[model samples]
Target: MRIAQVCNVGEICGGTAACAWSITLAFPDVDHTVIFLSPPNSRTVEAFQHCQFHSAKSITDGMIRHLNVDLVILHNSTPNRVAQIRSTPSIQYHHSMGSRTAADVHLACSKWLHQRTPQSTQVLWQPTPIPIQRTDNPSRNAATSLRIGRICTPDDRKWPQSLIPLYERLAESFKNVEWEFIGAPGTLRESLQHACRGNARFITADVSARSRYWSWHALLYHHPTISESFGRTVAESMRCGTVPIVDRKGGFCEQIESGKNGFLCTNPDDFVAAIHQIQDRNHLSQLSQRAQDSSHEKCSLSIFRSRFLRILNQLSLGDSFDA
Candidate 1:
């Protein structure tokens, strides 16, 4: 089946771009094409050599005539694209928590996101892919606390500032723990650097290599976010065997089981206390193991492919279109 995945493929920092990449990679058997609205840079354009890339001006005509894409997957926050592709058999994947007017099959990454959308909209829950090699680490240290920093575009909805206080408290309250910030170097990194002033425990580094970005040593610390359709980083952290301390928001409340796979905090105080309590090696080790297990069960490539293909089959069977 020919599938056209449409989104802003130029964006490398946000979850939307990451989700698009993952989806494309997961379903390699189906002929895939990525339609980018903006002019893609050399790096972005080169990344998806396996899939056909088309510019916005020629996307519609190509989709209708040349490609004849059987299924079109539209990433959220692209209403104009959705309107343009409304006539095609499409599935809208909601990567953000907001209202959308157009889409054939509306898939929400979290329950919170689904609740906010129109009830009539066809919704499905699918977590973002967490690509990591499943390895049995015999030397996995339980006592060592690794606090991985987050990388986010400057958006109030993501609550980027929430990490400052949480990290500060972690540094002050614990000694063995180390914090590292990874992502594109920007105002957020500068802000985090300034916040870590006089506090040498917190370290910041811009991500240079994509391969090392999601390493097992990087334990993700995501504080409360105002709007998140699904926390992709949470799954990525778990896939790498890095424990995540997420604020109870959006789908995080549903994804994380406190004291099992990861820690969930209600507020800044609760967040700080949770970090302090899990400072021991034993707890971190257990959390890491549980995280790896949980990721394998829910976010593994095989499971993702099965669920996605099932959805596609259902859509195809129900629709009048012939294969």
Candidate 2:
């Protein structure tokens, strides 16, 4: 079936754009078109040669109609903007906790989000493609310095305003650990550089590479100020078999079953203890395998395809959906 994935961001940077791109990749048999409300990034435009794209300042009913798509999926669109396409059969998708657009059939990306959303919304986990190469290091032993990574867009809003102290504490507690910060903001990186002198490595290059996700033995993530709606980074890390230690609030609580696949930290002390606990090579290996196994069950490509087809069937687009 022909589908139009409409998004507010033009670049494949944030979770909304990432999910749209992932959904496109998940359904290879379906014809997909991406509509970006903002002018798209040149690199992304060049890289995505397989799909048709539309870059516009605003989206309207006429614009969507012109695409001749069987379905229109709106990502993080404002309520007022969603009203413009009243005539179209569309799914208003919420990617953030802030999205409150009312629709007959809206979709939330996580169970946490679905619970908080209006009762009408359906939960649809974002599809994350598994890396073709397995990067799990089975030979890792107790002598190895556990590499813990933190990755996200270099935005202050995505970080805790006072995370320097936490980083310092983690650095002081484990001298042998390697702290890798991918896409850390400049000021944050400088502070971490100072506190974590030899123990830390701030990586500004190759932030989106799949290998980066798989390289980490564990992911240290905490955003007490801003809760993630679905925590795509945590999901991606899990897909790569990287155990994530994230804040116990927001969508993170849904992804991790503390002391199982991953750990959900409720406080700074909890974070430190969780990291220290994983120092055991045996425990780390078990959690990593469990995280990878759980990710396949939660967000794998096959699950996404089945859900997409189910949603299509519910929309009466089943006749057109060959898959």
Candidate 3:
């Protein structure tokens, strides 16, 4: 069947974009057209094959008409787009539904995200995939000291000012620990620079590419976030055999099993203390192994594709689609 995946493609360089790509790639037999809200970069556009791309403004006229789209999948709800496409068989896969009106079918990346939507909305759990292959890197097991890291896009909503004091304290208290901040360089430069100042143990790394970002030693540190639908980076870290020290917020609780896979911190002091506790080589290895195993079962590409296809079948759209 002909399907139209309508999304703000340009705005998505992270998990949401990866989810869209996974869906399209997984169902290759189905005719898929990506209706990008904004034009994607040359590299991003080249990634998808056998998929037609259209501008958001022309989506209503050009996309629906030309493609004769059987089903429209809305990633993020646009003001009138959902209503406009309501007549057609549409599914709204919410990265974060926010305050928008519910769609015909709502899919959430995590249980926390699913609960926020209307009860009438259909809930499908769609987690992000870990692109990096699992490796037996010697460095992952060799380190005895805790290596805490944070990844964000330099948004205040993500890396809040509250984390500044926490990060400073961790740097000061921990002797054998190192803190790394990875994201857009200049965006959080001032804040990160100020927080790490005089604390030679803190390192701020500019992550312009996914490869570079995932190359670090494991044991990610994510403080409590105010608003997050799902944390894909944490899962990705797990896939690379890196344990995550996440706050008890959003999908973090769902991803980690407290001491089983990784530590769940309630506050800044708890986060630091957890780090100190897991600094032992044996404990770190066990945690890393558990994390990798968890990623394989819950967030792997194969599992995501199989679960997604099964969901479509249960929705009775599987037979309708060519694949």
Number of the predicted model whose TM-score against the real structure is largest: 2
lDDT per residue (tens digit) for residues 34-81 in model 3: 877677656457655558776665345344556677777777756555
Candidate 3 residue runs with Cα over 4 Å from true position:
28-31, 46-51, 58-62, 86-88, 99-103, 119-122, 133-139, 142-146, 154-156, 184-187, 197-208, 212-225, 320-323
Total clashes in model 3, counting residue pairs 3 or more apart in sequence or in different chains? 1
Candidate 1 ranges with C-alpha deviation above 4 Å = 57-63, 84-87, 99-101, 119-145, 153-163, 197-225, 317-323
Candidates by lDDT, descending order: 2, 3, 1
* Residue pairs with clashing backbones, model 3: 1-322
**Cα lDDT for residue 189, candidate 2:** 71
- lDDT string, candidate 1, 73-98, tens digits: 77764554545455567777876655
For each candidate, the alpha-carbon lDDT, in order, equals 0.61, 0.77, 0.63
Window of ten residues with lowest summed lDDT in model 2: 134-143
Count of backbone clashes, every candidate in sequence: 2, 0, 1
Q: What's the lDDT for residue 208 in model 2?
A: 46
RMSD of 3: 3.8
